[model samples]
Target: MLASDVCPGEETIAAYVARKLARDERDAFDSHLDTCSACQELVAAVARLAPSQSADPVTSIGAASTITQAAAEALRLPGAQLGRYSVLASLGAGGMGVVYAAYDPELDRKIAVKVLRHARAGDQLRDEARAIAKLAHPNVVAVHDVGRADGDVFIAMEHVDGVTVRDWLRTPHRVPEILHVFEQAGAGLAAAHRAGLVHRDVKPSNIMIGNDGRVRVLDFGLALADLEPGTIVGTPAYMAPEQQRGEAVDPRADQYAFCVALWEAVAGRRPEAGGRRPEPGGRRPDPGEPGTLEGVPDRVRRGLRRGLSARPADRFATMDELLSELFPPVPRSRRWM
Candidate 1:
């Protein structure tokens, strides 16, 4: 049976899991599982609900013993209502929450719905929504709505049809192409900085390239209006020194992460991971040092080195400044000449 032909139920799933289903039925269910996300989720939930080996297996197939409760709700299958939007399918999930591809009946359009993990995370989700909603740049994902549903906070935003920069980098790209994508993403980050908000988490995975060929910076879950000293946040590999030290951060910190991502894209490895450690006093090794950025151009290496500086002050004062360094403007000829 194909995915469309399968209508999974608690009993059917339980029978399949308990090995009570006939060979043909099991084969058909297996075929459906290949493409049915809802059924796949049910199978996972069944696994979780399974009793220990010492205990008798679930032979009876009524409701699958707790399958219809929390597990079912967590699945958020198609037609499930989340605030004003109807959940179509789950796009992905992370530490923050699960992102669902949903449809807005009133607006008659599809949107990405991020259901935060913590029910009490409404304040933070609202903050993120407000911060992103204020940014009108083409490189920033647009926020459409934010609300609470069934004790969960959800943010509705633009549904981008594309892959993360991390995935995009899986395919080899020219230096110019890499710079072009990051330039657009940097513009979005710069726009956030201009609005007095700091994206505490900026990494390659947080940046995406849409099917329309536009690059966008997204997932401002850690963003905030005011920096609180001693509050550490962000991915460790891409974090600036200050961010890792629990010190207050600014736009320059984001610049450091952007450079790290760019460096990885160009050099095929992170600076530290490439076996280059910081010099004494915690400063990064000079870009001009031998064996660093071997094939990269001098100008690009210089900009990346500065952006990855240990001290925020040593890095570019603003994202726009760093972008300028990475993609310098063509000089105009003098009219008199």
Candidate 2:
């Protein structure tokens, strides 16, 4: 018997319905489930009911992430190979599935693949795969392939070798270096927002730093429509106030986060637990967060302050504006060649 049989009331109903939908299409109502605890609990229950197929202990950073990691660990099957790609090792897990480092023998390529566990084995995974595949940008990580193998749904993407923005901030860097990183990151976010996608979760962990000193955004799993309020998403520290209350959002939301990240990078301290303070003439100066713009060029500091505006409308309308300010077009000499 399934766990749905033992659950009471709406939980059972939600579980059965979700499971059915998950069987049909895993991504169909992922945004729906992310916000609904009853549904999330049901999904968690279904995962718990599934027998353990592997002996590995699921290691994760926090409580909310455990559900996804544990679920991925349970769904791992034996001797399953797909389309010239061999699964090598588990990278990490998120709210919905497990990502693994896979090897492609035919082209001699390495890829990071995420597979849905439990009810996410079907359409839900497909939808996320499709949504992410549509976005092709240098700063935005690309989705290479999506399909199913041995009853599990999978997404194969470019494997980036780098540390997260969170990892980079573990130690202090020169203020100038921090500013350059923030400028690049803001450019990426602006590009994605322009394409009509909202990255619901934009914390330090989701930002990857390449060995070449480039910053890229990862995990569009929680992305949604700019105006929708379906799922209450994002980590608390980096999450905007509206996200916590399940309200509408847009590019400005991303801009706000970019500012916060910049703040943390430069100041090396989390912003105080208060909303953005308003300023006259539609401008607000840095709240004197020590070293916020210390050692950075004044031009970049002005842009960062604008992007972090409490009101979305008051911030840069597009990432292009922010990038141009951060990295002005420098003329190159033809004689160099």
Candidate closest to the true structure, highest lDDT: 1
RMSD of each candidate relative to the true structure: 10.6, 10.5
Candidate 2's residue-wise lDDT over 127-152, tens digit each?
Answer: 65566788777777777887767665
Computed on alpha carbons, the lDDT of every model, listed in order, comes to: 0.73, 0.60
- 1-337, model 1: which lDDT tens digit per residue? 3243756667677676555666457646754653465566656455444533224334432454466563565667889999889999887643345678999999999999877554334466565667667778899888887787887667789999899898888899988898889889999999989987788778887899999999999876565322345745456667788876788778988998898888888878777665566555456666677877777777898898789888888888999898888888879987984
Q: Give the TM-score of candidate 2.
A: 0.64
lDDT score, candidate 2, position 337: 50
